[model samples]
Target: MKDCENLATCGFFRKHLEAKTLACQGFIRQYCQGDKQDDCKRKIYKQQHGVPASDDMLPSGQLLAGHEK
Candidate 1:
């Protein structure tokens, strides 16, 4: 999908979900431990599951809508 491709360009959808999740939990990124690829995989997972995020952000309770993860 064009929309998904666009979101992937800057990793906005990818980072936004991670950022939102962290923000929701009040994480301050106090450490430098990194796992960039995993985050991307999450985004892809969200996508394949038909989440509502720009790329694929599962809704609060939908858990990826009608799709299985």
Candidate 2:
């Protein structure tokens, strides 16, 4: 489906638009215009995954490393 169409159907998007929140409208105006689907994808990915789409926010730690006294 197209990005605009997908966004229009999103529950969060629809709710925010219906509520007429300034931030939501601004975001839609900025990222949901024309062919910039990646913006929507990243937003949705963050919503579903509970983290930023990029790796920068991931927790830093050594795998299987025990506590060091």
Clashes of each: 1, 0
Please give the distance, in angstroms, between residue 24's alpha carbon in candidate 2 and its true position after superposition: 1.1
Residues 1-69 of candidate 2: C-alpha lDDT, one tens digit per residue: 344545544544554456555654565565554454455654566668775443211111112122121
RMSD (Å) per prediction: 10.1, 12.5
What ranges in model 1 sit over 4 Å off?
1-39, 52-69
lDDT of 2 at 17: 56
> What does candidate 1's lDDT look like per residue over 1-69, in tens digits?
112233444333345446566532221121111333334443455567765334333322123333222
**Residue range with the least summed lDDT across 10 consecutive positions in model 1:** 24-33
Which pairs clash in model 1? 53-57
Best by lDDT: 2
Enumerate residue pairs that collide in model 2.
none
